[model samples]
Target: MLGSSDPQNARPASLDAIDLSMLAELERNGRLTNAALAARVGIAESTCTQRLRSLRDRGVIRGFRADIDPAALGLTLQALITVRLGTHGREQIRGFEQRVRSLPSVLTAFHVAGADDYLLHVAVESAAALRELVLEHLTTHPHVRHVETQLVFEVLEGSGMVPREPVHPPHV
Candidate 1:
């Protein structure tokens, strides 16, 4: 919760230009073959494998996932729901986080700064479903004091985006 997305507890790892290039290429195409990646990075296949393993071990490459469209899945509605908690106790915060993680409609949840405590990216089949999600999973919680929802008109994909420089991930 200290940062937007912090690294897991992992050893400190430095990145060279080659590593950065591999990361950029992977960011563009996570499903690339090892040989393709090696060729793109101008490195041997064995070296690419080792480098990828090292990146994963160091918590650089978190995971590869499909970017599913909600509309294609019959979930035509998307929303950004902001939530504010009445209390900030450690147990309450932990409890709230655990509770939010269990919800299926939540695409992503951010324990954030500013006026709200959390911002939830959710997708649902209809407006009624969105209401149900908020009532059942969010406002019903004892600590949640306020909830606001905004409908999403569109979402542009940029999952492959990454900085050219190898930024150090803060150890969690």
Candidate 2:
């Protein structure tokens, strides 16, 4: 709820470009202290703290998180599986989504608007394990009409879309 979506009700007049700059710095390095963030964004430490509080109040600043490495955690194999459902109705889509989400290997499932109605990002131990995942999980589902898997030979980037960058403050 970072400021209301309603344009008229959004950020207060006192909140300006400097506050936004603080937010941007936090986005790049979530673990940065208020003092550190203040220095980087060239604001007073107390002002940085207050601005951060305002951002939090508005719901702009969500909880901080550590980025976990899946590969290091022994999740080696990753693939993108495009699933074509037998029917594209809303109920069917919801049912399929719930079931697909329940699978252990299915990291993310996106209902796309192209040739495939659903795109699944999965990670497993090996190629054989991937085949088993496709067989035991995806194909067995009732609404699943066609399942196409593109084995990720090498990951230029690992599974799932990177989050969009936080909007930067406009130049003064």
| lDDT of model 1, residue 89 | 99
lDDT of 1 by residue, 81-148 (tens): 99999999999999999998999899999989999999999999999999999988899999999999
Best by lDDT: 1
Clashing pairs in 2: 1-58, 2-58
- What is the C-alpha lDDT profile of model 2 across 11-103, one tens digit per residue? 643446686677667767789998899898898999888888877776666568886655776779889999999987889888988988789
Predicted structure 1: lDDT: 0.88
TM-score of each: 0.85, 0.72
Q: Per-residue error at 71 for model 2, in Å? A: 1.2
